[model samples]
Target: MPLHHYLIVAAALFCTGLAIAITKRHFIGILLGIELMLNAVNINLVAFSRHDPEKLSGQLFALFVIVVAAAEVTVALAIILRVYGRYNTVDPDEVNDLKK
Candidate 1:
């Protein structure tokens, strides 16, 4: 595929992910949106790597991003589980623990 095509796909995925993150009210939904955004970034990195075969930095960074995202999801889900246990809901508006 062309570079522009890859970039456009990446841009679309990023925009959709942003919209989901902004509009979703549930904690898990927000997490899914974040994963989507991260995947979009990975797509871009891989596409760039393919276009420039001389350097593997983009692919390396993409791998790092995937590892980080996995760790983030693990921790975030744990926290979300605790929050749900405490509040019985995952809606962002329902979380008032820090309202003081």
Candidate 2:
């Protein structure tokens, strides 16, 4: 496949993720959107790196991003779990203050 094809797919995925993030009310939904966006970025990175045989910078950067994204999701899920326990809700809009 061509680089442009990958770019188009990534762009679509990114736009979909952005829309999801903006429209979703639930914490998990927002997380899903973020993950989608990250994956789209990874696709772009890999696509760009494929043409270059001398250097693997883009692929390496994508790997680092995946690791970072994993850690971020772990921390975010932990925070979301705590918030749900305290407030009994997963809707971000419902949780305004930290105080009980």
Candidate 3:
């Protein structure tokens, strides 16, 4: 309801997303974490948009973010699929061909 409440929710979502990204081993799991973080950002954007009745910039920005996130996921998944085809696994640690 209040701005502080929205901020707290955003913080909690960000923390959860961060924890997931840090602990996940699989590529898809990490993508899910990123999606969570993106959703948190969207929530914050919309919350701020509600406070500003004159301009809709925050809402517009959130829309652009959603579009960009969709494109990113599409490209990222394609790359992951190719990597899996080569490595036979999606584990981040297992795909170490670039390791020195």
Candidate 4:
């Protein structure tokens, strides 16, 4: 397969994820969007790494990204659950407690 094809798919995935993250009102939905974007990045990294002649830096970077993403999701979900316990909702726009 061509490099451009992988890039195009990555672009589409990233755009869709961005749109979802911006439009979604629920915290979980936003998280899903973020995961989508992360996966798209992984695809790009792997695709580039396939063409590398020396060290597989792109693949290594992608591995770190996945690890970081996992940690982020864990922490974010914990926070989201805590907020839900307090406010009984996950809509970020509605959580205006910071203004107080």
The number of the candidate with the highest lDDT is 2
Residue-wise lDDT of candidate 1 within 27-76, one digit each (tens)?
88899889999999999999999999999999999999999999999999
Lowest-sum lDDT 10-residue window in model 1: 91-100
In Å, residue 33's CA in model 2 sits off its true spot by 0.3
Residue 79 in model 1: lDDT: 94
- Which one wins on TM-score? 2
lDDT of 2 by residue, 55-93 (tens): 899899999999999999999999999999999999999
Model 4 lDDT tens row, 1-20: 88889999999999999999
Off by over 4 Å in 4: none
**In model 2, which regions exceed 4 Å deviation?**
none
Query: Judged by lDDT against the true structure, how good is candidate 2?
Result: 0.94
- In angstroms, give how far residue 59 of model 1 lies from its true place: 0.6
RMSD of 1: 1.5
Worst 10 residues of 3 by lDDT: 91-100
Count clashing residue pairs in model 3. 0
TM-score of each: 0.95, 0.97, 0.93, 0.93
TM-score of candidate 1 versus the correct structure, residues matched by position: 0.95
Better of 1 and 3 by TM-score: 1
Q: Ranking under lDDT, best-scoring first?
A: 2, 1, 4, 3
